[model samples]
Structure formats: structure tokens, C-alpha cells
Target chain A: MTTATQVEKEFILNMGPQHPSTHGVLRVILKLDGERVVKAIPEIGYLHTGIEKTMEDKLYYKAIPCTDRMDYLAPMSNNLGFSLTVEKLMDIEVPEKVKWARVILAELTRLNSHLFWLGTHALDLGAMSMLLYALRERESIVDIYEACGGQRMMTSYIRIGGLAKDLPADFDKKVRHVLKLLPEKIKEYETLLNSNQIFINRTRGVAVISAEDAINLSLSGPMLRGCGIRHDLRKANPYSGYENFDFEIPIGKNGDAYDRYLLRVEEMKQSLSIIQQGIDGMPEGPYRAHVPGVVLPPKEDVLYKMEAMIFHFKIITEGFKSPFGAVYQAIESPKGEIGFYISSDGTNKPNRVRVRPPSFLNLQSLSKLVEGSLVSDVVCAIGSIDIVLGEVDR
Target chain B: MEHNLNEIEEKILDFLEDKFSGSIISRDKFRGDWSFFIKPNDITLFCKGFLNNYELDIKYLSDMTSVDWFDHEEEKKGRFEVVYNFYSLKNKIRFFLKARLPAENPEIDSITNYFASADWMEREIFDLMGIKFKGHPDLRKILTPDDLEGHPLRRDYPLTWEQPVFTWNKDDPPEVIK
Candidate 1:
């Protein structure tokens, strides 16, 4: 008979600025005693590009594309938050059609982000096939984006004052197709993992956090909702015509990885309904708001008319001068509440542009959530939070 | 809606004036948002009141960031401003608190005791802006590497300045590749 040696000391393990399961360049310093994690200190900033500092040097309109790079998965939502801040500072109300169209695009972007999250979250938990199915559904949304914005992933479509252009002629057809196909596919995802023993064992009762702690840590969106807190910014403080839409905020009971997964899946369903409402009730008016010297003129008008050409030239060259004040505008991003705080100094260039990235703040709770849990559960905890390092290190 | 805002504003202003009378330097209302400049030392006190007050239980801390005013055109209180974005989840309202720190050594008390989320926010501020957060448990560089010298977000830090090669690992000599 062999006698077991007693191991009393905790060893430190560095889990990657290069590991595959981390989803990006994120390094977690895990202090462990055998198989249990005593403390998990997440060391980020490997992917820091200083996008916020870069945005301050660029013109106001030039900064929109930079926002796209922050939350690469939810580019349109980031654009919306930045543009809403600029509009709020300039006091420009978008046309009704622009509002409705923005709503559709934003919800579609939310769907896009959630689909990617679901696929990666499932794959990390050893369900390999879920990724393929999730990516297939996500491709359709990308097609819609390419059709509208002329770019696939980094589509800076939603510009200040209005969209880059009008919605494509086939926008309605493509959106309705996605709206019809997603419900059944979402059910397929649920059927595959909802009852699977392995999935439940990996996620349920693992990396649990309470509602009060979640709030204290400033976790938002699905992270907060997973803790059974019914606080959705879209419902509580509606912006960009979100008040007009009818949807439900999903909450979970356990605040574990499983509950967060279910909440994200249900959120995808809610997003489909919102897209349906957007397409059905889109108002009829000018796609871009008429703000000369501020909003860019239509391409057709720029080609045909001299005044429109002059306005375009002015906006492109010098850029629009904004009033001297700061405004914080937040929107319900797929990850959480992504807000932009802009402080203008009566110049074309912004004096300060601070992005309140949800990923950065949400990732702060990683240490709190992963402490005292098993080492294997660390991946589950990170996946449940759904952090994009691009946004986290921005 | 506007009338209701006026009523809430009156009630909260009355309550704040009654409670924190001396700490509030000035207040401004713009674009339906209220901002108050509080004394740097009394921020934690105001935040405690904001959390425990029945009507103004602003428990959720949305964000905390710092702004550098090196070449700013506007007249300001100090060379640096730390902005706190607080929200009341129950009442669904947003407010701002700003504290000004002098140029010599910009320092403020960390709100980690009142709001746990301020840990990383203060660390980031300390890292990028070089504003010392007194009493923070882990006050170290966050978004930047450990070897970085100057605060990158300050106006004095040049945008095009480059870090010298192998400076971070200076102790380990580099071998020549023939």
C-alpha cells in the first residue's frame, strides 16, 4: 500500500496570454491548491491598442471606425453609442425612419454578438458541434450587414445623425428570413445542451455570484440578468427609440454559468422579436437627417447639386464643430451597457473621449467569481461573462 | 416628464443641501443630467450618503474615469478632473460627481470601500493618468505594462513617442543574430 503525500502549499499557474480557451490574448494568474483555485487574478492589457487615446486625436466623425474596433463583435452597437453621444452634444434628433432603421440594425448586431458568444461558450465546454450551427445562423446576419453597410465585419454603417445610407431595397426580405429561421435554430441549440448531463455538470452551480455582489461589482446586461436582477437599460432608461419597442428582459435564478447561458439564449429570442417589430413598423421619411454642415449630404445630392457638394466638402475637410460640453450616452450592447462620454471643446476634434466599455468593467468580477471554484470552472466563468479582450484592453 | 424631473430635482437638491451642505462646491444641470463638483476628500462621504439614502439610493456605479486638462481652453478648478458616473437602479436616474486634483501630485481617496468596482477603475486611472488613489489595496499599472514610465493619457505625453527597444527587459542582454 502506498502512502499519499500531504500537499499543503498552493502553487501558482499562469493560464495564458496564449491559451486556446481564453478566446483572446488574456492571461489569468491562478493560485491553486491541487485542483481547486484559491484565487484567480486576471492580468489583461496584452491587447491594449490605446484606442481611446487615439480617438481623442481624430476628428469627431473619424472616431466612429475606432469604436468598431473596440467591441469587434458588436460593431454597430459601439457605433450607436458613440454617435448618440455626438448627437446629444450637437442636439440633433434623427428622423423617424433613421430611428427605426437604427433599431433594426442594433438588434441584428445584438443577435450577431450573442450567436458568436453562444458558439464559443459551448465549444469551450466541450460541445464542438454547437459552434458550426451557431456560426451558420450568424452568417445570415453578416450578409445583412454586408448588404447594408458594404463591409462584412467592421461595418461602420451607423454614422452620426443617421445611417451611412438608406437600407438596401432587399433589407426587409433578408431580415424577415433571419427572423423566421432563428427561432427553430435557437430551439435546436436548447434541445442539444439544455438537458445534457455533461453540459449541466460543467455549468450548473459553478462560478456562482449573488445579485448583490453582481450589482456591487457593476456587472451589467446578461451578467446582471443572470443574478435575477430585472434591470435592462433598454427597459429602464430607453434611448434611440428603444422605448417604442416591445420586448421582455430575461432573468435567471442561479446566477451560475448555466443560468447565464440560458439567459443569453433567451435574449437571442427576444432580439428576433425586436427585429420583427422593427421591420414591420419602420417609419417612412428621409433616411439621413437634414443637417447641413453637420450631417453629410446624400451621395446623389452631392453629385447633382453644388451646395450639397460644398457641404460635403466642408464636412469631410474641416468636420463639424460641436458645442463645448460633455455628454455620456449609453446603449444596451449585446455584452452589456456600452457608454461613450464625450467632452467637446468647441472644436472639430474631441478634447476627450472615454468609452465605458462593459467588457472591461464586467471582467473585473472574474477574480471574485472564480475564487474558491475548481480550476476547470474558470473557463466556464469567463465564458459566462462573455468578455472580448479587444474591448477589455481598449 | 419634465415636471416630474423638476419635482425630483427639488426634492433631491433639498435633501442634499440639508445633508451635504458644505461639500458641494457647485452644481450644474444640462441636457437633463445633473452634475455636482464635490470636494476631493468628501467624495466617499457623499457616495455613502448616495447609497444609504432612502430616496437617493444610487447604488450602481456605472463608470469612473479621469480627464487631463493640460492645454484645456476652459477655466477649470485643477489640472486633473476625476469624473464619477453614478446611477440609481431603483429610480432609474443618472448623475455625475467630479473631483478636481491639483497638478503637483494629483491624488484622491479611493472609493473601493464604498463601491468595490472602483478597484480596477482607480487602478486604470492610476496607470494611464498617474493619479494616485490613496488607500487603494492594489494601486498599480493596469492597462499598461509594469515597466512603462510616464502616464500615456496626460497631455504632456506625446502621441508619437516610442518606447526604446528591449528597455523593459534591460537586465537580460540581447544576442546578435548573425
Candidate 2:
């Protein structure tokens, strides 16, 4: 009955499915009233490839590549999670050397992922130079991936029983080269943003989530740690011989966007230290376990030995069978806790393969973080969560 | 921690037996992680109990997913199973709870009240597996388009490729590539 000017109007704003800041093809629907968001609903699955359904059709060993595409940034961690789950079900144990190498590769993967997040998040917040500098450091890590796995990005190096192959002869030297350079590179990144007024002003007190709310929302990795919860699966659960390596779980007190930034920076340093320790304490043994039917034989053995050739042929034609059971294995991927739940019906192919992708869980907290903040801060809030749409849509 | 994990599992089993009584169908352990199957009717009650239990304090809902068992022989009771993965941050232990739902009307009480994280997960299940979550505030398709016809994750849903509506060349009439 009143005039139109007297009534307050709220409108729905669609943020993305194509916008650069939303990370991938993530579309966020926002109910706004004059620059203030009333409700934010994230519409996902634009990149959905039905990887879970596809995995069920693939053999246990063949499914590793599909995991790589989920969290494309941290492919090795995905590989480690899938492999460990399968290894647990098969009751196969890799040697100590395999464990050490796997840890190194996984940490490198973490560093690679964090670097990408830092660059992209900075770019989202208008810090253009940070992207170039971050990518410069990431190049060396990509080289390491390429050297070992023959692919830069989707290196499914970590296999079911062990590694795809033993570490290259110069793997130590190449890793040491990157490790030596990372500290200085990280320092440069910190110097760029740590005390910068614009960076601090834009990030501090923005997208704040409390410790209780974080746990209730099932946030993980730096998202939970930024809320002052010192929980890292690498430390708490200790899969892939993480117990052997000594590294502190970085925690943040402010539980804001800036705090998440600080936590990821600290995690990069810790990952470097873990990589250093792994190289120093390298164990000497076979790279893969001695599960003949399940794990592929060495290339040399396959070429000469008849038994090895037969085993290889058998495995290539018909993949190894797992018992009828279900197992969940979680690893501390750079994004968060990447868990795999596999149910096998004593067949070459899995009955069901469910990935508990960290990005999917972490992205849920975005609404809570951005609800009360200015609509302009939405990009910062989303970038701080560091969600890879590959993982989210999977 | 090792001793505490065992104690936690035992306490959880005891609590379920004492509280739910006849609801629990079976229990099993996989790679040191405990999993329990509960009757569909008591899922919400059991989840509430577990989440609110003083000692257990299963505060985090890590994942909420469903599995279609249309092709499996062992799943005699139902055609679909809803799986809930819970983690206790205080105790640093994880346990999985599963409930069976018939294929006809796969619906369960939503746990969004207990864990806000369950909102999106429940929606994802609904979108992909065609499982409905009762009491969900905004139940809608999450990943898939709203107009998508059938749940893709169901066993009965064929994985065959869909034919494109447009053809690469107009002169050749149309080659509906599937």
C-alpha cells in the first residue's frame, strides 16, 4: 500500500560460472540488499565429469589417474590417497624407501598446490605481481614432477603398492635444488604481502570463521587451522609414514582471510623442511612392495624373466582382485583431508569408489564466511578457501 | 592414542547397543576404522545421539554420500545405502555410519541441523543419487542442472553418451553423434 520508495528491495545476484575469481566454473548466487549479502548459495557441478561413476567401471589400478584429475593441483596427494586405500584393502605394504619417497613427492605436491593458490588468490585480490613471482617458484616444482612422473601437472606418480617407479638418479639433486630455493622464494612472497597495507586491509577481519563454527562446518586443512584448531591429518592420523617426518602443524589465531594466508605460507615452509628431512633420511630398498599379482614387476624383470613376464601379462590382462570389503583412507592433501572410500566385491574393478574431496567440504563454509561481509569481499573469501573445482565437481 | 582408539570404538558400540538396541543390523572394521549399519528409521535418532553424546562428541561430519547397490548380490535389504563419515576432532578418531534405503523412495532425515556441512552434501546426494533429505531447508539439484532428468549415479542409469542437438555441418543434414 506504501509508495515504492518506502519499501526496501532485495535482488538476487549471480556471480559466476565464468568469472575468474570464483576459481573454476563455480557459480555463486547471492541475495543482496545494497552491497550487503543476505544469503549466498554456491551452485556447483558445472565441471562434473562423473568421475565417481567412471571409477567404478575402471580397474582398481586404473582408477589412480581419475583421482589425479579430481584435485588437479595436488595430484600426487590424490594418488597417495587412492593407492593407500587400495593397498589397505589388499593388505600390501611398501618398503620404507617407498614411504620416504612418497612423503617427499606428496609434500612437493602440497607446495605446488599452495603456490598456485597463492598466485591465483593474489590475482583475485588485485595483486598482479604476486602471481608472476609465485609461478616462478612453482616452475621448479613442476620440473620435479616432470622429471619423476613424465608429466608436469597430472603426475600420478604414487601407485597402489608403491611408486610408479623408483626415484630418478638425480631426484635427490633436483629436489635439493628446489628445497634450497623455496625458503628464499617464500620469503619474497611474505615480504610482498606480509606488511603490505593494501593486502592486510583487504584480508584482515574479512571472512572470519570461529573455531567452533569451523569444526561444525567440517572445514579442514588450513581452513580449520586458520580458526585456531591445530588439526592436520598428517599429524593427527599420520598416513604414508608421516609419523617419521617431524614438522609442526601451523595454526592461526585470527580465523580470518589473512590468517588462512599466513597458515598456508607457514605450511609451505614446513613442507620444505619435511622434504629436506626425507632426502636426508632416505632409506635404501625396493620402491614397490612384493605383491606379485597386484603390483607390476620391474621393467627389467618383465623383459627377461618368464615368470615376471607372465605375471605382468596376467596383471595387464586381468587386474588383481581385492576382497569383498570397504576401507576409508585419508591423506593430508594441500587442500585438506582427501579420503577415499572403496568397496570391492572381490573383483578387478571396484564395486564403489567414493572420494571425500577436501575442496567439497571446505567450499561449504564459504556461505558462512561471506554472509555478513560486504559483497565486494566475496572473491577474497572464496579464494581464501582455496577450492579446486576439479575436486569440488568430482 | 592406540589404546584410546580402541576404547572409543568400544564405547561407541556399547552406546549404540544400549540406546538403539534393535536398530543396529551389523558392525565391521575396515583398516582399523569402524563402520556400523543402522536401520533406516533410526538413522536420525542414532546420529543425534552420537553427535550429542558427551564422550563421543562426533563433532565433524566429513562426508554424506550414497551408494547404489542395484547390481550387487549382497545388498538384499535395500537397493541404496546412505553413508555418513564422522570425525571427532577432540578424540582424533573417525567412524562411519551407514543406513539402508529402499530404491522406491530413498529419503532420510537431514542432518543439516546437527552439522551445517551436511547441507550441500545432502543436496549433492539428492542431485546425483536421487535420494531425498527430509527437513532440508533448500532441497535442490546442486552439481547437475535443475532440469536434468535422472540421477546419474544410479546403477540403472546408463553411462552411454548423449547425442548432441547440433550438428557440425548443416549440409550433411545431421549426424547425431552419441
Candidate 3:
């Protein structure tokens, strides 16, 4: 019998299921060759909650709340995507005010999502101050969320018919106040991150993916846009009256982390433009459409009026039946083209509900980008992709 | 009679009269959608022919997924169906190709040879729906785990194995809700 060799040739590196910096239960099994990742085998499902099957059992209306769990960073966008699919299947028309409200809130949510991305992403790279500063700016949007929906993080505010309820009387003022302060705060962030030498050296050419490769990998949102793909679902395929709004699509030439960073900085400015237009050209109408039977009557209306009370009772108990059909609705979420495919069987419960989450696709490109790069470069690659595991694992 | 969407459907139907039948597909100017039910073996040929030979140029494979129709109530021969959504990004035309495959033996030709984007997508289908990608190079799990047994997206799969917390009015079980 031969004695076992004293020296070990290979060592296994176990990444997080509970580590804070892994962002979310993303356990990556890295085969190491002396600080170099030879083969990266990602082990997922620690955060697997089986969201898809639950949607199959939940009714079309009941499924909206579940969406809040998908991309917890941008719950509003997921809510919008799911709601849009239900609306398409039901073939219910939304009011102008509702569209504007969706755009504004969705944009605010985009800002919220990006702030979290920038914070956590910068935090991963040891930019401790950026995380604090970014979170400080993001708190305004969280406050706005709390004031409107009585929840800060997962606000199931955007309902299928139009909204959970009409925008509170203080909605307009709170939104405008935040909008006014955002431009200055954004400039402050740009000044800090745009010219920082350490940040520049770390991100400039790291994790470069060309436009063609980005498309082939099916990357979307900022990752795709960062690769000079002048495509945004809001622009390419308009939903929620995005056509009426005027905004520019900022493209990147280098298709690197720096380019992505630059593009997002510009995007924040463009988002500001879109929000201003939405508020300026804000239409006045019934927040929800005239689909009385489909939309739940207001609490006050239900409590006061007998007709409203009866409709509310029926809607709450039996649930409004949607048209029997399948429809796929996609929206330009902060991440990318978040698509919702819903199948209705002429019943209260949905036959099927599927979310084509962007982070999942964006994360798919990780292997391609990480295949040859250094292990340290992996952090930048992860940051550049800006994936939320909530959406990815969902 | 001109080249309306219905006319196109009728034209395709007339061309492939040997394969399809019924009013399930018609040109009613209805939903304004084009759907093609293709044979599992014919998907590659159809996609290539639809793009190159037929000048359909369906260059963009927008999404490809497999669905478990276990709770479908149809009791049909097949328990699952694979859906491929194609888009001609140039012409702005969209076509949906669907194929039914038995859940017991879910195997189909991988479309990665035609559209490179289908590589990860097919792997995802295999990972989530347990559809065996016959010709895929890497047919392992993309989003889940290596040792994970059941595909979680299937209708039969439970949402979560964790038990619920007992409320004030509800009866409390002895076991911990883990």
C-alpha cells in the first residue's frame, strides 16, 4: 500500500449562503488554482421559495402581492409587469392618470433599485463612503414609499386594475419635493464616483462585454444597455404611455464597467427628465378606470353607498373573473425587460403566471465574463451585472 | 383575399394542409398573433427555413421555455409543452412556435445550433422543467443546483416546504414550523 501524498494539489473555496457580501444566498463553489478560479460552479437554491408554482394556485389578483418578493429592490416594477399581464388578459383599459402614476412611481422605484445597486456594488469594492452616501439618497424614496403605501420595502402598491387605491392627497407634493432635491443629490454622487481614481482603475475596462455578446447572452437592462445597445423596452415597446414622454437613451461605447457606470449616471439624469415631464404633463382623471366591476370600490365609497358596498363585497368574496386567454406583457424595469406571461381560464385564479426576470438572464452572462478574468475582477463583474438574487432565485 | 394576417395563416395552412386542421387557428383579425404548432423534430428545420429559406429572418429568439401542464385538466397524451417565442427584429414581426412533449420523456432537439442564445435557455429549460436537452453540450442546471432532484417550477412542486405560523385564532401544532 502506498502512503497518501502529503501535499494537497487542489483546494475548494466555498462562497456564501450566509456571507453578507455575497448579496443574497448565492453560494458559489470555486475550484482554486492559487488565487485563480479554474472552474466556477455556482450552487443556488438556498433562497429557492418556489414562486412560480404558487402563482399557478393564486388568483390573478392575489398574485400581485407575490411579485413584491421577486425583485425586492424594485418591487414596483415587478408589480407593474405582473399587473400589465393581468390587464392584458382582462383587456381592461387604464386611465391616463393611472399611466402617469405608474411611470412616476416606477421611475422612483428604478432610482431606488439603482441606488441599492450602486451602494452594495460600491460596498463590495471597499468604497465604504459610497454605500452610506448612496443609501442616504435612497432613503428619500423609501420615505416616499412609506408615506404612500404604509410600507418601505415591499410596497404592494401597484395593483392589477390600476392601483391599490388612488394616490393620497399628499402624493403629488411628496413626489415633487423628492424630484426637486434629486438633481442636486445626483450631481453630488457623480462628482464623487465619476472622478475617483481608485474607482476608475477598478472599473474602467474590467468585465467588458461587447454588444453582440451581450445580446447573445440575452443580457438586459443596464448590462445590455451598457454594451451600447440603444434599446430600452420603454422606447422600443412602449407601455404605460411611455410614448408621450420624452427622454434620451444613453449608450456606452467601451462596453466596460466604467461605461456602464457612466451610462447609469446619465440614466439617472434622463430618469429625472422623464419624471419632470410626467409631473408637468400630469393628467387629471379618475385614478382607476371605469371598469367598476373589475376595480374594487374605495373603502369610503363601499362604506357609504349601497351600490359600492355590494360591488366591494362581491369583488372581495368571489373575486372578479378575468377574460379567458393568455397574454404576455413586458415592461422596461430598472433591470431590463421584465416580462409577465399570464394565462386566465375565465376564473378568479390564474391558470398560469410566469415572470421573465431580467436579473436571471443578466446573471447567466456571469460564466462567460468570469471564465478568463482574475478572481478579484469577479466582484466588478458582479457589480457590473447588478443582479438581485431575489429576482434571480425566484 | 389579399395578404391579411388571416390570409397568411390560411396560406400556411394550405401549404402544410397535410399536418394541421380545425378552427383552432383562423384569420379573424382577432388577437393579431401568429402561432405555429411544430413537430419536435421539425423545430430546427422550421426555424432555419422560416428565417433563411422562407425569408422570415426570425433572427431573434426572444424567449424559449417549457411548461408543465400537469394540472391542465385536459388529460391529454402529453403532460408538458415547450414554447419558443421568435421575433424578426428587422421586420418587427413576432411568431410563437409550440411543441408538445410527454413529461415522462421530455426530450427535444436543442436549438442552440441555430441561435447561439438558445444555449443557456435550453439548459434553463432542462434545469427548471426537467426537459432533457438531447443535443445540448451543457445540459446541467443553470439557476438551481447540481444535486437538486425535482424541478421546482413544475406545477406538482410545492411553493415552500416550510409550515405556516399559527395565528391567534388558529390552533397551534406541536411541531416547530421549520
Candidate 4:
């Protein structure tokens, strides 16, 4: 007869590639010693579409649509990041109105992404009705996106030089309506999740990473902020007139699953305030910058004037030539820093278009986050990271 | 609390010149971010020094990626440039370090020892661009199948559509109609 200690051994357990709690098609191979995870190795690439390779073959103006697919949840934020990088490469200044409008749209995108994350994360923890309630609020935001740019999800409204078109007539009214309603809805969500004993037990003190470890791991946005390190790129490296907006960066203390949840809730409220400020201080000017042979001519002008027609034809056919230089532009997307390292070769097509996806980088910390936690906490830890595998495997 | 951007850039440049004088190949500033081009062999030492230094405590590795410079004649000193973007939370500054590697055998020293975040990023560069990292603990394909043939991001790789697996000729399709 053998003793129980003599027979004990560790075995490997594959958690995903199709698991519901992974937020996308992500596989985590966890090594377990009777329900305690000894090692967690993330396996990706199930959703890879080779978007970066495809971007290198397309023209500069045509690549904007590709960025939207990288982070499908925060399409507008992806658009803004890619557009801002191209604009920097071209060294053209967009109109004041365009900057304000971009800020407002991107903030709305942050709120939309956080709501989806909250709902899906809650559902992963067995709260079924939260998905329906969260989706109800998300519908209003999607309606706003639809009102501005014809598509709700993949609205590549933010173009390279400026916005694709002027804001709709009722854009302001629709946005204000949604902004007014989101706060109370957020409050209801907080009442449901916060202080609930079951929710607390599942989240708090689970997957705790120190501020030092968070920084060393290069975790950003909420993951770094959850560790009580205030490192938001919007405030640190302000771009697209983020400097003009007055808002607070929310920080969390515990760096656990619960702190991350609270931090995103606070971020949604701050995004609301930014939207209100952007609309209140909205500037009036031309929607797009007037860069000949680069920015597209207005449709009416292209129809009427010969010079406008010629410019449009040239831009559509040959695309604009950027100076032979490289620029790295990062924007604080809903997830974290979505950066575009664009190396233009004095041609219409980019030499190299590398996306520093936050999900891909943030997902690196999952092993550290769930090293010694329970198997159940593995689900919570993955949910707290809020990774969109579309972005991760892009 | 707002430090002068130019002064910070100058300070970093001076420190690099003072320590490792001849290693820097070229330096440029684009969009207010300082970029330095260095030899591929010196990246490990430079990254270690940058992380250990007190004034330039660039502990955060923002991004690590590789760019293929295939066609440009004048700009092609090397076929690949592995770029690393680092950020200093204490000083609120961002910097770029690019290491030039030859196209035929692209390899560079890994910085995973300094920043734990570099593990996945290095793996990604290896998988997509075929650039190997010397000391990466686990270097495998991250976003591609294990048996994927060629590096997709290379300029020479064909961007054509995948071939259809099955096709039906006229003779093969006629039997199903009865």
C-alpha cells in the first residue's frame, strides 16, 4: 500500500482556445497539482488573420479600415490611433473641430468597450442577467456611433487627415442623451456588483500584482492603474488635443481583480465627463484639413470644381506620399496604449506598419497574475485582464 | 513638474555618448520622441545600462517590434531594424532604440532579463519577422501555426489568397443531379 503523498503528482490542464471566460479564442495551458495551478502558459494565434501583412500591401488611405478590425470592441480608438500616426507622419495639423470631435468619439468608444467588458466579465462569473442589462445601455452608444458614421461597430469615421465626414445634424443631441443616461446605469451596475459578498469573494485579493511587478511587466491602462501606478498615456503623452481636456486618472490600490473592476467603473464615469466637456467646448471650423493631394476633396467640390476633381482623382489613384521618415504614435485606447509604428518610404504604401497592441502586451501578465491562485480564480484573473483576442492575435 | 523635453533628450544623448561613444550609428527626433540607432550586438548592454541608471530609469518597456526595410535603396543600411520603445514613469519621457540587423541572418540579444514583458514581444518578432532573439527562454510562433512555412510580414512573401482545397469539374458534378 502506497501513502497519498507518495502518489501525488502534477499534471497539465488546457483551459482554452474555446473557453467562454477567455473573452475570445485564447488557450491557456495550466499545470495543476490537484486544483492549484503550478504554471499557466497562454497559447494564442487561433484568430490570426495576418492583418499587419495585409496592411503593408494596401495604400496608406486604404489601411485605416484594417486598424478597426484589430480591436473590434474599440474600433474608434483603433481608428484614432492609426489616423493620428499617419497625420504625424504627414506633419499636417487638423482643424480644431476635428480634434474635439475625435476626442469625444474616442471617449464614447472607451465607455462602449468598458461596458462590454463589464457585462461579459460578469457573465463569465455566472451572473447571466448582467449581460442583458449591460447590452441595453450599450445599444444606446452603438446608436450614437451609427448616427455619426453609418456603421455601428466598424465605424472607421476617423480618417488619416481628419474625420471621414462632418458630424451629423443630431450628433450632439444623440450623444448628450446617451451621456446623460449612462451615469445612472453605471450606478445601478455598481449597486449590483459592489459590496455583494459573492462578487467580493470571487474578485478581491485574487491575482494581486504589486505596482513594481506591474511596471516591470509593462502593464498599462487599468492593469497598471489597478496596481496604484498612475500611468495613463492620455495624460502623460497627450495627443489629439487630450491635453486640453480636464479629467482625472483613476487609480486602484490592491491591483486585484476587484480593484481592476472598480477602476474601470471609475474610468467610465471619467469618460462621461470628458464627453460632456468636449461637447460643451466644441470648436467650430472646417471638419477636415486642407492638404492638397493628401486629404480627400469634399464631394460637392469634387463634383463641381475641376481642381477638386483632379485632386480627388490623384489621391484616390496614387495615394499621398509621406516624407521618408518613421513615427511612433500611441493613443490611450479603451484597453491601453494602442500604438502605430509607421515607417513610410516616400511612397503611398507604408514600408512597415507595426501595431503595438495593448491586449497582446497586457495578456503577457496573465501567467504572473494566476501563478498560485485557485482554478476558479483563473477565470476571474483572465476576465480582469479584459483581453480581446482579436487584438491579441492580430 | 513638467521637465523640458529637449533638455531630457539632450541628457539621454549625452549619457549614451559618454558611456558607449561609438556604438550609436545615428540619432533622430520625430514627433518629439528621441530615436537612436545602434548596432545589434550592443543592445543587451545598452538596455541593461538604461534600466540600471538612476537618472534615466526607463523601467517600462512600452513596445518591441521589428520593421523590414526591403526595397528602399538609400535607407537600407540593414534589412531589418528591431525597434524598442521605452518609457520612464518617474521622468515622464519616452525613447526609442533601434538595432540594425542583416537580412540573411537576423538576430539580436534579448532584453527579457531586464523587462519581463519582453518575453512575448520578442517571441512575436521572431514569429512574424523571422528575427531571432539570442537568449529568449521560449521562442516559438505566437500568432501563427507551429508549422507555418514562411514569415508573412516579410516583403518578399506573396500576399495572394489561399488556394481552394476542393474543386469540381463538369464531369464530376453531373452525377449528383439524378
Highest DockQ scorer: 1
lDDT of 4 at A307: 96
lDDT of 2 at B80: 89
Q: Where is model 2 chain A poorest over a 10-residue stretch in terms of lDDT? A: A1-10
Residue pairs clashing in model 4 are none
Better of 2 and 3 by lDDT: 2
- The residue ranges of model 2 lying beyond 4 angstroms of the native Cα positions read A1-8, B163-178
| Highest lDDT scorer | 1
Cα displacement (angstroms), candidate 4, residue A328, comes to 0.3
- Which pairs clash (backbone N, Cα, C closer than 3 Å) in model 2? none
Of candidates 3 and 1, the better by DockQ: 1
What number of backbone clashes does candidate 4 have, counting pairs of residues 3 or more apart or in separate chains? Answer: 0
lDDT of each: 0.88, 0.87, 0.74, 0.87
Give the distance in Å from residue A98's predicted Cα in candidate 4 to where it truly belongs: 0.6
lDDT of 1: 0.88
Q: Write the per-residue lDDT of candidate 4 for residues A306-375, one digit (tens) a residue.
A: 9999999999998888888888898899898889999878888998899999998889998899998889
- For candidate 2, write residues A1-394 as lDDT tens digits: 4566335566667788789999889878887777898888777888888999999888888888998999889999999999999999998988999999999999999999999999999998889999999899899999989989999989988988888887898999999999889999899889999998989999999999999899888898999999899899988888889998889999999899999999999999999999999999998999888888989988788989999999989988899888988888888899888889987777898878889988998998888899967888999999999999999999
True contacts kept of each: 0.56, 0.71, 0.26, 0.81
Residue lDDT tens for model 4, B1-103: 3557767767878998898777888888876778888888998888778877988777889988888888668336888889999888877788898988888
Judge candidate 3 at residue A331 and give its lDDT.
Answer: 86
Candidate 1 residue lDDT tens string, A1-394: 1233344456677787798788899888888888888878888888888888899999888899999998899999999999899999888999999988988999999999999999999999999999999999999999999999999899999999999988999999999999889999999999999998999999999889999898899999999999999999898878889989999999999899999999998998898899899899988998788999999998889999999999999999999888877789888899999999887778898878899989998999998888888988999988989999999999
